[model samples]
Structures are given as structure tokens and as C-alpha cells.
Target: MRFNDVIMALLVIVIILMIIIPVPLGWLDFFLALNISLALTILVLSMFVKETLEFSVFPSILLITTLFRLALNISTTRYILSDGKAGEVIDAFGNFVVGGNAIVGFIIFLIIVLIQFLVITKGSERVSEVAARFTLDAMPGKQMAIDADLNSGLITENDAKERRKKIQREADFYGAMDGASKFVKGDAIAGIIITVINILAGFMLGAFTMGYTLSQSIQKFTLLTVGDGLVSQIPALMISVATGIIVTRAASESNLGTDVLSQLFAQSKVLYIVGGVLMLIGIATPLPNLPFITIGIAIMLSALRLTQDKKELEEQAEFESEQEEERDNNDIRKPENIIPLLQVDPIELEFGYGIIPLADPNQGGDLFDRLVMIRRQIALEMGIVVPMIRLRDNIQLDSSEYLIKIKGNDIARGTIVFDHYLAMSPGVVEGEIEGIDTIEPAFGLPAKWIRSEDREKAELLGYTVVDPSSVISTHLTEVIKKHSHELINREDVKQLIENIKESNSALVEELMPNLMSLGDIQKVLSNLLKEFVSVRDLVTILETLADYARSTRDVNILTEYVRQRLSRQLSRTYFPFGKAKVVTLEQSLENMLMEAIEQNENGTFLSIDPMTSQNIVASLAQEVRKLIQMGEQAIVVTAPIVRFYFKRMTEQSIPELVVLSYNEIESDIDIQSAGMVSI
Candidate 1:
């Protein structure tokens, strides 16, 4: 063990040994002085520390000090009754400090005990109890605040962890302080009982056995008993006061003295009022004039000085403010100052004045909160973080029109009527309800705007009903999903790699920079998202890339391999039912497309004739329209190699069409060929 640890262990043992061992009067005096000094140090240290957690070990200190004081009391009591003397420290306090009057010394000791037990210790216990309870009660809120700050990028992960630790320490410190105050209370009661025992025992031994007169015995024993009590009670009183100070102190950036002075003298007006009150009393009352009048004049002079200082401080502040404004004006004129303006948000939803209430939280508009939830929802569904969205009002648009933009380019626009609900038929409606004719902004389905009164009736008539805010929110969600591929950047892909690296480091290290770059990884993820595939299963995606990246660094081919590797997810997502209806390509057509695949420096491309491609597109559309008329999604299943090229060729004409490979579909789903594409 270290030397300091040895000393601490020996100190506690010695304190316990003191209660059982006899010591010389000189040693007793030294120990008594040490006790006083320790108590004083503790008191001062408590005042100097700005926060309570800085003295988290105070409860243990309180227990140790109380034990030391009790042991000292026992030693002095033994010496006083057995030898008629304890030590010079106690004797001096009895005679010099209390004027050798037993009655006066005893009264002083009792007063000290009463003050500590009744006022300081009692109040400290109550405050500690309440503080501990409140600290624990507020723990959840503090933790949530830290998490929110981390999510909002206001603080880093390390900062959040540190704050959470501090909160837990606060709860623990207050809990210990609550229990430690009991030691002070019990010590007060013990002090009283020990004093009584010493006096009574010393009197009996002196008068009966020590061969002293009754008056002498009473006087000698009384003085010695009062002195011992005084020495112990003084230290106990200081400790109790320290306990109260620590429990009541608020968190601050400065020591107690500085805080007290700054807060007490914060306002010159309050000081001036007090000075006037004192001056009036000194002049009007018949009480002592010189003392009160002298103090009153001093206070008034201090107040005058304080007021003059305030004026000078205000003038300095105003001058500094003007200088700062001048510097700001110059800074604005600098060309580099406009650099921050060049950066644009990844996504922005700019609405008109009529849509303000739908977006303003203060006006019961939940659009801001809806946006937050939308980010989380997309993260869960797409396995990619939706960047921070910017919401604002644009006056250039129609009053009800709102626009959604990606990378500063407008993508979609919609209109809303506040306080009105959009009603659409589910094709099972019993009857038609009278309403304003409209189209659903999200899916472009036929819809109607109905009054608040008609919302319930429209729903009863089997029509789907939604509010204006929901309409805008749904439209925005669809637009983001369609354009999420545009938002994936090198940084975002790096974050995903880092996230997956935490668990699958070997896979990430194998693929990144060695075989593929950040840009390559981002491109592969974008291609997956462009097809509405969830990258949430990033581990599987990365592992597959690591296996195939060595053969070819082409992102398009890598994405194709990743899609096949995520066959289960594809099956579960696209074919939730046990059956599927899909359009299939003819074997001859598949072979022709696979043979037409060509490689270049840019990547792979389909080299088929334009006329044949157009004829194939027309033929595929004609076949896929049969499923569309049957209320089925347009799906085309082909060989894995031909799926990519065919999807690219037909994407322009049918952007919503889902082109799948036979390898992408799970075996459990029985596929019925609804039609076939031929050229």
C-alpha cells in the first residue's frame, strides 16, 4: 500500500485506540488542539468549494471527526475524575476563556450544544433529505436532456457521458449527506450525557475518596467538567455548522464569500434604502447617537460610491457595444463573410403564410415535431439518417401553396386549406358526400376537401379522411423517400461505415480504401435507396461487398450483388403475401439483353439498338398494363444480369415500375406469370 493509505488506516485505528488507552497530559493537549484545527479546516474548506460534489467525501469525514471528538471526550473525562486534571487546553478554556466560573462555562457549553442540535444539524438533515429526493426525481429529465442535446448535435458523445455521470454523483452525494447528519445529532446528545457523567463522578470521587472538602470538591470538579465540555462542544459546533453550509450551498462559479458579496450588494437602490433607514433611526431615536450615527454615515458613503461605480460601468458597456457594432459592419463587407451563405440545407420545406399555423408549434401546429418524427421514421425504414430539415415561410408562393426542395431545387408542390379535412373514397363508400373537388397531394388520388362537420359523416360513408397537416406531412414524406438517394454524401456513408465498423470491423477494413472508397460506398448505398431498398441491414450489405469488391470495384455491380445477398429482406418487403403476380421476360429477349451488356471506362451499359429498345419498352408497357388494370403493382422479373440493364432502359417511361430479378425473390413465394415481354 502507499504511504498515505497506511497513514489513513493508522489514523482510524489510533482514534479507536484513544478511547481505550491512557495518555500523558501533554499528548492529550496536542490531540485536543489537533481536533480544533481539523474542525476549523473542514469549516473553511466547505465555504471555499463552489459545489457540493467537490466535497463528495464529506459524509465519511463527518463520521471520522465525530468519532475523534467522542474519543477525546472520553480521555479527558477519565483524567479529570481519576487525577483531578486532564490537560492545559481544557483547563485554559475553563479558567481563561470562561473566567474560571463553572456556572458560566457550563452555560456556554449548553448553548453551543443547543444551537448545533436544534438549528444547524436539524436543518441540514431536512435539506439533505429533500435534496436527495429531488435529485433522484430529476434524474430521468436530466438524462433525456443530455440525449436530446446529443441528437441535436449541441454536444458530443463524450460530453453527454460526462453530464450523465455528474448527475448520478449528485444523487449519491445528497443521499450520503442525508444519512451523515444523523451523526451530528447523536454526537450532540452524547456530549450532554458525557458532560453530566464527568461532573457527577468527579464530585463523588473528590469528596469521598480524594480527601478534599465538599466546597473544594464541588468547585474543582465543576470547573474541570465545564472545561472538558467546552473543548469538545466547540469543535462539534463548528462541524455541525459546516454540514449545514454544504447542504445549503447552491452551485456557483465562485466561493461562498464572493457570491454573498455580489448578490447582497447587487442593487444600489436597496443599499441606499438601508442607509436612509439607519440614518433616520440614528437621528430620531433617543437611543445611543454616536455609535448608530457613525455607522449610518459610513453606510451612506458606501452607497454613494456604489451608485457612482454603476454609472461608470454602464458608460463603459455602451461604448463597447458601439465598437462591436462597428466591427460587425466591417466584417459583413468582407467577401469571406458570405461563404457561410453559400451552403444550402439538404432538404427544405418552404410554405406560404396560410400554412404558418400548420408549421408553428406555438399556434398548435405540430409540423416541426412531425418533421422530427419523420426523421426517425425514415431512419428505421431506410437505414440511413435523414439530414436536418429546414422549415420556413416563403411569401413568393400562393397563400396555400407549399414547396419541398432538395439541394435548393424545387421537387414537389402542394396546397392546403386550414381547418379542413381531405376525404377520399376507399372504393367501398356507401354513398358520395358533397365536398370541394381536389386531388391528394401525396399519391395524386382523387380526393375532396370537406368541412369539419362533414368529416365524421364522410368517414361513416366509407371515405378515408385526413387533416390538412397530415396531407402536407404525407406529401413531404413521399418526396423525401423518392429523393433520399440525392441526400447520401461521402460524410453520410462514412458515418454508416463507422457505425457498422463498431461490430464488423474486419468487413469495413477489407472493403474501404483497400478495394472501395467512400465515394464508391456512397454510390452503392444510393443505388440501393434509389430502388426503395432498406439499407438497415447494413452488416449483410457490407459483408457481401467485402466478398465481391476484390473482383470488381464497379459500384453498380456491387449494388447488384448486395441486392441478391439481401434476398430475404427483399422477399419480406416486396412480397408480404404468400403469392405474387409478376410480368416475366421471354428467354430469347433475356439472352439478347444479356449479350448486349457492354463494359466501358465509365461502367457497364446496354448496347442494344435504339429501335429494339423502344420496341421492347412498348411491349413491356403493354404487358405490365394488364396487371395495373387488375390493381396489381407493375413488377418485371428477369435473370439477375439483365435486371439492371432492363430497369435502366425502362425507368424513364415508368419510374414507379419495380424491376426485380428471379434471384431477388424468395422461394416460398409462388410466382404466377401474369404476362411476358417480347420484342
Candidate 2:
């Protein structure tokens, strides 16, 4: 066994022996001294530790010490009642500490008991109860905060896990403390009972059984009983005080003593005022002036010295800060410093200073939390992991302006009034509102920045009103959706495959590492996402890819086959409750495109004439605009052989339009031909 473990086992045996066996006077004195030393050690340690967690073993220590003290009380009581002399430690305390007066000793012991039971122990118990309750109540909020930090990339997974463990430990510690305080309270009560029994039993045994005179018996036994009570109660009082300190100590980087000193004596001016008040009282009051004047002068000198020390420390810190800044500037001039500057966030939001309150929770803003939800929402809607966006403040922009950037390039910018509501007309407003005229950054709709009080009026007038955070979040969501294809890389594809492998290992193993490379799958998935197709159904997409991947090495063909397999998903998404409204190419134009197509092992490319390509694009653009104006999504249906080339042709002109092959539509869904594109 380890040394500490063996010692603890021996200590437990000793405590039991003290309770069951008769203890010699020397041993009783030794145990009493040991108890006092242990309690004193605990008190000093509690004062020095920076935080409660640093002394997490305190609850167990409290129970063990309480038991040890009880055992000692039993042994001392046996010694006093049997022989009328407990120990030399008790004798010294009885005569020297309390002037051999039983009444004075008992009063002092009672004072210690009352102070511990009523003040320190009671207060510590209440604080522990409240701390435990608050910790449990705030657990959900704390966990959510940790998740927000983890999701926002402020902390790593390991850091978040460690923080969660710390929170749990704090809760458990406070709960243990809530129970441990009861041990101290019970110890105080037991001490009182033991002291009373020792006095009554010791006197009877000394006078009647030992045949001593009444006055002699009372003197000897009363002194010993009071002395034993005082020794036990003093140590108990120290422990109770320590318990109060531990429970009441807030978490800080400094120890309790240092924290108290720094905060209580931080201001020299307060000390000066106190010293001045003392001096005035000494001169005015009809009492001894010398003592008060001397102490007041000492306080004034100490305050002056503190002021000087504070100034010197500030000057030293200033010098160190300047030196550090110079060293940093020198380091920044190095090539290594420039290397970090080259690395940019994949997605970022830069806002002006005025918008900081919209992001900072301390200022009643929840933009960071909102952004976390935004990322999750986009992942669910677009079926891709949106990268963590870095939020920062820039002073070069207008105070109310914010911009979204993808890959170090600004893609969208918006401006909002800090404390005003953005009232937008959904289609038309019932009445015009008086406010600052502005364009809504998310949708470019006409909006007015109105007072918060006007929000009800705006809503009553059939206008949609939103706060600044919602405006920024909505803009960021749209920007992410538009650039999701660019965000997916080989790592994301690898992650998806690995996640799938956990449940369908055989299928993933058979398809990956043998049939297609990771890059090839990433390309196909990126191609699907380029048209805003949800790749959430990975089992189906991978299965379709595995079937056709061996025959063709082209990623585009694989993506097209996957799309054909996912036609049902597409049909439901686009045509939720009605027929699929689509525009189709004329037979002549389709044949012309087929004839112009050139195929190779690499891929298919349209080798059409310039005039023919222009005419086709012009005709398609006209029909696409018509469909959009009628509030219908523009989808072009073409033959399976020409779908790829047709999409490629009209991609630049109508990027928002979706082109599907004739075979890609499900047979169950009704189709409506809105128009036809011809050249």
C-alpha cells in the first residue's frame, strides 16, 4: 500500500481505539494537541488557497476531523470520570488559560460554542445551500454557453469538455459543503453535552467514590471539565471559521488574504480619511489622546507609504509595457509574423464599433448566440457544415455598417441604426411611417429605420419589423447559402464518409479506398451543392455513385446520376404542393445542342457556334425572367443527353435557374410546361 493510504488506515484505527479503549493521560494530551494543530492547519490553508476547488478534499476532511474530535471527547470523558484527571493539556488550560476559575473557563467555552454554532457555522451552511442551489439552476445556461463557445470556434473540444467537468465539480463541491456544515453544528452540540456530563459525573466520582471533600472535588473536577470543554470548543470554533471562509470565498486569482488586502486597502484616500477622522476624535473626545493620536499618525504614515508604493508599481508597469510593445513591433517586422497575416478566416463578419453592443451580451446583445443558431439553421437547410465565422470590429467603416466576407473577399455589406427597428414592407404597407429611409441589407427592399416605440405601429400597418441582430443574421445566412459549394472541401467529404462508416462500415469500406478517391467524391458533392441541392441523404448519394463510378471517371456524370436518383427529394423540395412548373427547349434547339456536343473521356463540352449559343442564352433568359416575374421558380427540362451541356450554357446567364433532365423527374409528380425556349 502507498504510504498515505497506510497512514490513513492507521489513523482510522487510532480513532476507533480512542473511543473504545481507556487512554492514558499522556496519550490524551497528545491527541488533544494533535486535534488543535490539525484544526489550525485547516484554518490557515483555507485562508491561503486562491479558490475553493483548490481545496476540494475539505468536505471529507471535515467529516474525518469531526469524528476524530468526538472520539477524543469520549476518551477525555472516560479519563475524567474514572480518575478525575484527564491530561496535562487540560490541566494547563484549566489553570493558566482561565486563571483556575471554572466559571470564567465555562463562559469562554460557551462563547466559542455560540460563535461557531450561531455565527460561523450557520452562515457557512446558508451560503453553501444557496451556492449549491444557484449552481444547479445555472447549469443549463452554463452548458449552453460552453456549447456556444465550442460551436463558435472560441474553444476546442477538449477545452469545452474540461470546462464542463469543472462546472460539475463545482456543483458537487458546494453540495458536499452544504452537508458538511451540519457536521460542525452537530460537533458543537455534542461538545456541550459532553462538557455537562463531564462536570456532573466527575464531581460525583471525585467526592463520593474517591472520598474527597466537597470543595476540593468541585475545584479539581470543575476546572478539568471546563478545561476539556475549552480545548475542544476552541478548535471547533477555528474549524467553523475556516468552513465559513471556504464557502464565502469567491473565485479569484489571488488567495483570500491577498484579495481582501488589495480590495479593502486599495484606495489610499480612504485610509487618509479614516486617519483624519481618528485624529479629530482623539482631539475632541474627553479620553486618553495619546493612544488614539499615535495610532492615527501611524495609519496616516502607512497610507502615504501605500500611495508611494502604488505610484512606483504603476511606473514600473508602464516601463515594462513600453518595452513589450517595442519588442512586439520588432517581432512584427520579421518574415514569420507576415506569414500569420497571410492566413485569413474562411468566413468572417466585420462590424463597426456602434454594432458591438448588438454582439456583446453584456450590452443586451445576443449576436454571437444568434450566429451559432444561424450556422445550425444553414446546415439543416443547405445540408453542409458552415464554417465558423470570426466576428471582429473595424474602425475604418461607418459606425453602423457591417460586412460579410467569404475567403477574404467582401460579398455583402449592410448598415443599421443601433437602437432603431428596421421596418420593411412585405408587399405593401397600409400607411407610410416617418423614419430614416434606407435599403434593407438582406433583400434590398425599401425599409425605414424607425424608433422602437413605432414597432407596434409598423406591425399594425402590415409591415415587418426586425432588430439589428436579426438583420445581420439573415444577411449572413443568405450569403452562406450562396457560397456553400465553395465551402465544402475534401475534409468535409472525409468527415461525412467517416460518420457514415460508424453505422454502415461495410458499404463505406467497399466503396471508398477502392472505387473512388476522396477528391473525386468531394467534386461530385460540390457539384451537387453548386445548384443548392441538399446532400443530406448521403446513403442514397453514395450508393448511386458507387454503382456508376466504375464505369465513368467523370465527376459531372456521377453527380447527374446521383441527381436522377434524388429526383424525388428535389421534386418535393421545389414543388411542395403543386405541379412542377418548368420551361422546356424546343425540339429543334435541343437537337442543335446535341449535334454541337463533343464528348471525350475527360467530359462533355458544347462546341456550338457563337451566334447559336447567344440566341439560346437570350431566349432562355427571357423565359427565366418571365417565370420569376410570375413568382414561380425557373426550371428547364431537357433530354438526358443534353441536360449537362444545357445547364453549362445557361449557368452564367441565369445562375439561379435549375436545369433537370427529362428522366430526372419522378413519374408520380405532375409536370406543367410554363413556356418553351426556342432559337
Candidate that scores best on lDDT: 1
What's the TM-score of every candidate structure?
0.61, 0.61
Write candidate 2's Cα lDDT for 1-679 as tens digits. 6999999989888898878998788877888999999999999999998889999999999999999999988988888888888888999999999999988988988888888889889999999999999888667646755664554344557889999999999999999999999999999999989988888887788889999898888888889999999888888898898999999988588988789888898889989998898888899999788988888898899899999999999999999999999999999889878888888888999999999998899988889887787777767666778888999999998999998999999999998886798877768768999899999876677889999877767766767777777778878877888788898889888888888899989888878889899999999988988888989889898999889988988898899999999989887887787586789999998898889988887787889888888998899988888888878888899998889889988888778788988777778878888889999
Q: Write the per-residue lDDT of candidate 1 for residues 118-140, one digit (tens) a residue.
A: 99999999999999998887676
Q: List the global CA lDDT of all models.
A: 0.88, 0.87
Model 1 lDDT on a 0 to 1 scale: 0.88
Clashes of 1: 0
C-alpha RMSD (angstroms) for model 1:
11.7
The pairs that clash in candidate 1 are none
lDDT score for residue 56 of model 1 = 94
Give, for candidate 1, the lowest lDDT window spanning 10 residues: 145-154
- The per-prediction CA RMSD against the true structure, in angstroms, equals 11.7, 10.5
